[model samples]
Target: MQHSVQLTYDQNHSLSWGKFVGSVLFAFFGAQIISGLFIGLPFMIYTAGLSDKKTIALYSSLGNTGGTLLQLLILLLFIFKYEPIKKLLLPVLNFQALQKVRTYIYLFLFFGLSIAIHIFIISKLFPHATQEQDLALNLENLNQYKILLILGSAIFVPIFEELIFRGIILQFFQQRFPFWIAAIGSSFIFGIAHIYSLGVMVGAFMMGMFMAVLCKKTNSIIPAMLFHMMNNTLAFLS
Candidate 1:
């Protein structure tokens, strides 16, 4: 009877594992769709008729912002639709790893350190050439429409990206894999998605892992969101 009971438990665990993996894939694919749309639409507009670099940039920024919003919407929907799975996610979301005040300081320090590393990497690699063009310049050219770019960059991108990567994808991994595996694996995927440069990739991947860990440590998505927001704000300023 004990052996039979063990077999039943194992079967149920296996089923749960499959479901978790499926959910993670769904979230990943959804983010990709939104992300692609964001990057592609502006290029389409530029190819079709828009001759102005500024106009293209503004449009691209809008796409980036909108894509993020869609990602957040997906996260909410997934959480609502899969309450049982979300329960499994809660522990990862509410990690008790950093209960000390020093941890908060360390978190921000890490954020700053990562940014410095990216800047240095960009300097070494591109040397006199800017890798990713400044979206702000493009938006500025649009004059009236620039508000859209600002809002999208300063708010939308951070919120949406964090929710998709940290809230959904990381948690999805955590439910099935060990903590380190989930964090690193998701971070690697997140880093690769950016396609900026080697330095940028390393910086982004590191940030991704940190954000994932933060989400787990805090047991709340807000911390990661805030961190991402600050990072984006800095990017906009730079």
Candidate 2:
């Protein structure tokens, strides 16, 4: 009787479909709330009665960096607080996925194809399209916080993104759905997160699809993270 009860207890603790959905929503909205209340609110007060434009710029720069830190903190907390989510991290970070030569070849191939789709297909189709933001120019505008901005946008952004989108969302759905369903479902959400113009949305959708494919082929998220970091680094440099 005790053994059966223990098994039931374990099953309850495992991540449920509802639990996974809740975690994703919590991580996103929790970060937004924390940033607004703690970072933006405080900065607004600090800048009050100060008409100097530099003071306003300084406030924005600091607020932006603080917001990034808070978002990272919130997502990390959400992941570590759950036992099953923690288990997923090992498979996600598994280095064995890189042992096969075909994995490397696939990485290069998928990445190149994604670029081609984004540049040749999407951009050409909608000549006015761009990323949700001109991230490179944003960094330049907030040059006072360039280091923090770069780390936030380029490094930490990809880490949390792969962990959430591919690691959690895609994997969860893939267990019950077909691969195409899982990939498109996750990619759709991923692309929607960066939404603005139609072309930008399509391009992001293609990148998300490629990233999902990379994770599927390698059976890990590490390669996807590397691919994302490399992609973002080049964007900033260009």
Candidate 3:
């Protein structure tokens, strides 16, 4: 079972400046190191050194696999040790609230249209370099492992990111800044953290905005996480 602190204006059971800053810094750095090691550093090492087909393929495969596992481990640790979470990790809400067909439709449209636009823009702008790195491996090389990769990308990563973003960052920002400001700022940070490609960064920013909206409207992270998961699932499948 999950435990949460109920906060109200009257009680205002918030952290002191020192504690708040420390907590935010810890989470931010932890996220950065974990995300960077998994996707960033490995990608850099591979692209910077390996030019051969076999070497590139091997490096890419290892990086993606290892990074995903590391990310998953971090997420599990955060969830399991929720008691130590000094700050709100996610916008608290009931799961049943997100069971509406309308919610599903909204999320489907948002994810589908946004990703489609990103793809279209990428194709138009840089058709030659699209998936240049990934193409070295091809679908043939990723047969059995594809399933695990898909699960990590579509299901696991989205949930993990949303929980970190909409749940933790959003709540913290909302306490200090205007709602829109907090949402946009959090989304911007999210986009920059990926630092993959320009197109991917823009898409990530848009995703952050979408998740923020869900969190703001519902006052909970459940809808955002669900929408994020569904979005990743579609990306993985397609």
Candidate 4:
């Protein structure tokens, strides 16, 4: 009877984990698909010769931002409504007192680390990759669509990404597995999601790992989100 009870409990736990994982995956992918469609709508309209390329790109970027924000709103609703997800994410959302000096130190450290890894990835690891070149070209060409780029990259992307990866996925994995396993696994997924080139992937992985560590240390996703925003802002400026 005891053995049977234990087995039943384990089965229930596994089912719960499976359900949570499924919900998260659905939210993530569904948002992306929906956002892609929304973005494509503007392009299609532009192709109908109603708007210029820059106007279409700007509208597409706005659509992308709206989709991302909608995804976050849906995920936030889920997080609040679901007991399991709430329990997992409560620590991340809860306010905590932080030392000003220490906070600045950590911010600087993470920012510097992100820059160093990006430089190393571009210069040594994937020297032939045009990741930096592509970034520069994009920046140079952002005369009219600068607002769209800033809003999409510096604001929406960081918040949504941190909530999804650090707040939900990493915390869920940490519950089921060891810390390092969870961190690396989530970081790998994060890297793959941003896979434009080898250098970009490596940089993203490193940044993800760093953000994971920050989330773990602070027991809050706020810091990670801020760090991500800072990183994105730097990239935008550069």
Candidate 5:
């Protein structure tokens, strides 16, 4: 009787943990989408008369920033309320890890070169598949809001994304599953979250996998965050 009761208690505990993790994931994604629409709709309506590329880009950046801020706020609430989450996040924010500047520099160079080569080869094989025109159009308009664009893309976006995807989601999965299963599962969702063109989706998936690997290797999300920030900053400048 005692054995059966203990087993039942264990199952109940596991189920509760699963539900908490699921709630966290759902809350982050749901709040992000809703906040984006809430913030973006007003900007879009207000700028309807202006109708310039730069104005639109500025508003879009602002909307994105607002959405990211909402996610950050939500994550902060979870971190404070959950001891496990706080434990998971605290190490990633260690100042000692930030001092490994050279390691991050190498990581950025290696991944940047690898991705560039992959894109080049893919472009050669599929000449009609380039999304550069669309990317260029969007990025070019951000020239007027250069500083805001840089801060939003390089700093805020990376911090928000890495914390949610790698720090929370991936770690949560890793606790319940094998490493590869957790990594691939999180990376796939990360790609879907981008909602880009097919080629960009593939790129996002690959980038997500790479970042997941980096997080696993370092046992901290800070390295992945730094890489993401550099990657975004370069893409914005390019």
Candidate 6:
């Protein structure tokens, strides 16, 4: 027999804030640590440090790709017992989600905003070198693992990221807060997860807000996922 558990919006309002922050932080770091151990255990036995480019690329690709997988798994676990989500996500995932005019509108607007962000903010935020230089160096280092990196960044990470940030966290906040508040709050954590690079952090924040709104507007995560996929793909190629 199947039973559906329905949680009220205000029933657990007191701890919502703490639960909000705790869930995001736990999932973010938990993914990193779990994936690190999963992929790093092998390198731990052989190399003290990754001096070899191939080793570094292999390590990065496997670790990152594996990390995204872990994140998805973790997010799934969080939503597993909640039976209501399937309905919100079930309606859209068709050709219309990708083909709808509004989807393109959101993508175009965010694409323009992303460029402005790179020009106005990211260029100045680069501490030691330019973002382009950083990317070029990373590409060079990836060597044989470049494809894996592309797959992780362009596909897996977007799905996992959107699932966690906009899908789970944003919805959690919405249960207790206003829509805008929920979007911004979840977007903030989305940005923080990409704290490794200032430019990426800034860009992620903006994109997160955009995707959150899109998710709300479309009533599905599919559009956000497509937008995220394109954004990461362009970023990796650039």
Against the reference, the lDDT scores of all candidates come to 0.65, 0.76, 0.65, 0.73, 0.70, 0.68
Between 2 and 3, whose TM-score is larger?
2
lDDT tens digits, residues 1-238, model 6?
Answer: 9998887654435334555566656556766677667665654544457588667667766766666676677666655543444332334334466767887787678767877876777666764334544564456655467678678778888877776777667777776679999888888888877765666666678888888888777777788888888887776677
TM-score of each: 0.69, 0.82, 0.67, 0.82, 0.76, 0.73
Lowest-scoring 10 consecutive residues by lDDT in candidate 4?
Answer: 6-15
Candidate 5 accuracy as TM-score: 0.76
- Ranking of candidates on TM-score, top first: 4, 2, 5, 6, 1, 3
lDDT score, candidate 3 = 0.65
Tens digits of lDDT, candidate 4, 60-162: 5555566666666767777777777777788777456254456556767877887887786545878854556356345444435667677777888798888
Error of 3 at 15 (Å): 4.1
lDDT of 1 by residue, 1-238 (tens): 4554445542544235566567667766765576567664655666468776766666665665566566667766776667755665455454344566755775687687767766776557655333353432443443345466556766776766665577666766675689899999889988886765555566678789778777766676667776887886776555
What is candidate 1's CA lDDT for residue 109?
73
Which residue ranges in model 5 land beyond 4 Å of their true spot? 1-21, 24-27, 51-57, 82-84, 91-95, 100-106, 109-113, 120-140
Clashing residue pairs in candidate 4 (N, C-alpha, C atoms within 3 angstroms): none
Q: Write the residue-wise lDDT of candidate 5 on 119-178 in tens digits.
A: 776456545433553464465555567777778777877887887888777876786789
Q: Cα deviation in Å at residue 158, candidate 5?
A: 1.2
Error of 2 at 106 (Å): 2.7
RMSD of each: 4.9, 4.0, 7.3, 3.3, 3.8, 5.8
Residue-wise C-alpha lDDT for candidate 2, range 151-225, written one tens digit per residue? 766788788788888888888777668998999999999888876667767777788899898988888888898
TM-score of 6: 0.73
Model 3: per-residue Cα lDDT over 50-145, one tens digit each: 677656655555566566657657765764465434346533644765767766666677666767766777457655433542354354444336
